[model samples]
Target: MTDQPAPTDVPTIRTLVRLAVPAVIVGVVSALVLFALDWIADIVDKGIWTALPKAIGVDPASGWWIFGVLSITGLAVGLVVWLVPGHGGPDSATTELIEPPLKLAVLPSLALVTVLALAGGVSLGPENPIIAINTALLVALVARLWPAVPSQLIVLITAAGTIGALFGTPVAAALVFTGVVAALKTGGALWDRLFLPLVAAAAGSLTMTLLQHPKFTVPMPAYTTTHPIDILSGLIIGVIATLIGLVAVYVFPLVHRLFHSIGNPVIYITLGGMVLGVLGAIGGPITLFKGLSQMSELIQNRATYSSGQLALILVVKLVALVIAASAGFRGGRIFPSVFIGAAVGVLANALVPSVPMAVAVGCAILGVTLVIARDGWIAIFLGVAVTGSIAVLPLLCLVILPTWLMVSRTPEMRITLPAPAKDPQTPSTPASPSPGA
Candidate 1:
């Protein structure tokens, strides 16, 4: 492959336009793929949670049903991962939010497992695997159609598009990818560097929005007035939640290893399902799945749950997130972290009515997200999006400083980086050539 000029340094206006058109197409296609995956998962969720239970003559919401469905889901996932062609396309526990594109042959297994986890009541998100799938598929397609386009460029646009689709807005993708683009030393104005990717993200976000209403907003009282107490409460909530997430971060490795000790996907994943089933029985259905709809559900039905009930939900969901992530399930952590933060926010409002509802929720999200994702900007974006109140933005920006300090010195909630691969030609034991042999 030949090295080419950075898109940011393209010579003419026509070139920028040329790059952005394909990017827009990539974004639209990526968002469509995401929508298709979710549509399929939704159908499966109803079959398991509704049709199957009715046929079996059990209450769909019963603990027995939740446990039975989740365990069966786990067994199914375990069997596919163990026997499938590509081992489920890399353990999500070991990968970052975005990694290199997977080989195309691995996409189906990855997609199948991802849908299973979602439909089966697993407490993980689709972000990590979906991003991998889109990146790989897009890279391959672009290479076939326009071989001159660089692989890295396609990767950035595809990722940006998926992120935009996930958050239902181009802004989230922009915030998420800002640090990435800025890091490239190829020198240009940041937005110039951001141009093609942002175009793709906007297209993706628009497509998802047109397909369905975006879920970014929650029905909360408008954050109208601000007092010194608001900042104080927000900071306190942020600090406490960060500390809570840290416990899971530290404990994650031990739990991951314990499940891995089972030594097979069918075994470990099945065991993971059983643990999730028990937790589901304890926490009930609210603690299941990726937690987006559930997050809104908790807020919409806030009056139904006692403060103590909210606290239990928080703890149970936190544990479920850990077990699902550690136990070889194919999913992402961000949505669950958001759910945990939202739960924490609800609890904070119940315990201390003095704090504004939006502020409490935003801060809770900010803190937990900071610890789990270790991305300050994206954390702030989610916090604001949850509350739908820009009034809390400045306060959140201030509190994020302390939250970052808490997260900065801690171990990230990811597996240790794999050891570098040794070159096959490099000798395990260096030997000198026999003298003039």
Candidate 2:
């Protein structure tokens, strides 16, 4: 009998398990760390938003308390970024989810500012910092413990796991990484590379589910069936929201550069905090935090608000997101964008009750998320996730084609890299002597 040669395309079961086992452990650890971050942020949130307000006899919903807390949060974050060992790591505004891992020493400052931002009602999420911290930590750990594991593999797995843990599902990791991996022209089957990442993501997602993490779903009218009007309205909402989100994207760099030009961390961040505080004061307590709970709150009490009120909430949250992002805060824009998208949907419903709530929301989310995240799958997932209706998913899928057309060739929501700095040690030429001669 002749023994056949092994194929490079298909991985053996032994090889798959060998890689999958450590990935499982990494996923568990990532889930645990994510929980820890959330727990810590919750504790801080209670202290500032609940305990302190009650103890001081100030209403938690009052403008003064909101202003004070956000201002203090800004000041504290500013001090940490200015004096801390790592300058609170890289500015999240300038970094993406898959940027190079940060140093271990930088994680502490990043975590601190992230927690403060979360607790103080800063309009951002933990996605940027937490993902960087987990990826860096896992990469270093695996490099030391498992010498054979490639650093690139570990980074990919860690990222996939973190994304899984974050969204409470492996699908989000898969969708996000799909966009990432599909662009590569590597040899062999695509799943060969995605296999380990998917394994890690599944493990992380299962762990999070076992721990009973909340899923991302909003309360709205269920989508029973798709109609022509549904498609038309969805497209209209998607187009409008995408255009509005583009305005913010266009202004992002201008605002970021404007704040950065202050050239003093404390001053600029403090100023940013003040503006955020003012927004919080105007938008009320519902506008605070990373926007997850606020999104839920908006749904629960949406009936109480007038059309103008809903419009105000949408505008305030949008501006708050821009300020928080531009102000050098250590957080992400995804969750806040979700809130803004929801608000846009709610306002759309208020303006035109003829549109189904579920479809309006799904389309609105698809538009903003498509532009901001630059991933069609994630945007569509979030749109469907918020509606929690499978019927809405198809409508979202249909609306995304045009939404993609709007956002596909558009500028992504990121800062432009600065030019390389000149060396201070270089000697200057004697221009005056030459001119005299």
Candidate 3:
């Protein structure tokens, strides 16, 4: 019997180079595409709102009658999704979890999502789609460019690039990608090869940021609380946030089924837009689009929304997100989830009166942690960072431990298993002799 060459004899460096270069290219391209979409969406959002007053003969800067702006935006989103190729929008975490990744479809997928966000009038966010599409594109590009690259390496580079672009920091991106790759069980060796692509993606993201400043820039906050009780508040909020996270997971699958069962994704998506439009009409213009700017406004003007209004917005926004997401619309849940968390925290503060602001911070942290389990630190960073309150980090850290515990306990957390390679030499069962034979 002839012996086949051992797998150990396979070349590794050659494989790594073949995978890393194209992965970087894909990451760079996807980042540029995402940035352009974001810029265009910003222009469209501002332009429509700006024109609303002029068209109706109202003052543009007054910010009153902004409901009209929301409705128009919702209609635009509906139209785009209805006519777009991917129907509803680009692939998201939800989609990635459900469907196999497609490389060449990134651009169209991105376009669909950009349009969906424009129309849905949902206070969602962008990071999810940006990551999903970029990852898929980079992975696809690497496979196409280097047919010899291992599948595992391709997955790592895609993951790294996607994460790198999102944070505009390769280190953080690498951490996120590593965590996700680990969760997906793609293996550890790919991480070593991911270094170059990670660097390239971070550079690409930084370049994009320099060219067109992002509205949501992370800032360091000043910490002030020295009290033990305040530190304890973090633990309390983290527990509460973990509870909310559980609820989000329970609700997500139902939402997914509901939309898919509706038969036609486009119709449901358009309906989702209409529903969002009505919500916008009733809830005010803040209910529309990715809530990046609104989240900033909320943090800056903490008193702008009354406790009751904040609570209402949280519920409405959550529902809108489930609908938009389930109905085939694309966008990230991270930002919307964050907005909900913040609102919940604010409402908790108003109700309890005695709970420190740190408790609310924990609430935000837990809410995001439950929905997104991969990088709990990012959620912690966001909850504290967005508040622009450094005094809360100690409390935020307290919440992180329990929130992690709670998510780790959840049984339904999505886990992606690696595909088993086909065995070419495995003997096929001999077919029965044909009747003619």
Best by lDDT: 1
**On residues 80-164, what C-alpha lDDT tens digit does candidate 2 reach at each position?**
9999998899888888887667789998998899999988899999888888988889988887877676566677788889889
TM-score, per-candidate, Cα-based? 0.94, 0.92, 0.75
Ranking by lDDT: 1, 2, 3
List per-candidate RMSD values in Å: 6.3, 8.5, 7.8
Tens-place lDDT per residue, model 3, 306-398, is 888877877776666665555555666666766667666766666765666545644565556455544665676666546656666666666
Q: Which window of ten consecutive residues has the lowest lDDT sum in model 2?
A: 428-437
Query: Candidate 1, residues 9-66: lDDT per residue as tens digits?
Result: 5324455566777788889989999999999999999999989888978897789888
lDDT of 3: 0.56
Error of 2 at 113 (Å): 0.7
Q: Please report the TM-score between candidate 2 and the true structure.
A: 0.92
- Clashing residue pairs found in predicted model 2: 121-289
Model 2: CA > 4 A from native? 1-13, 419-437
Best by TM-score: 1
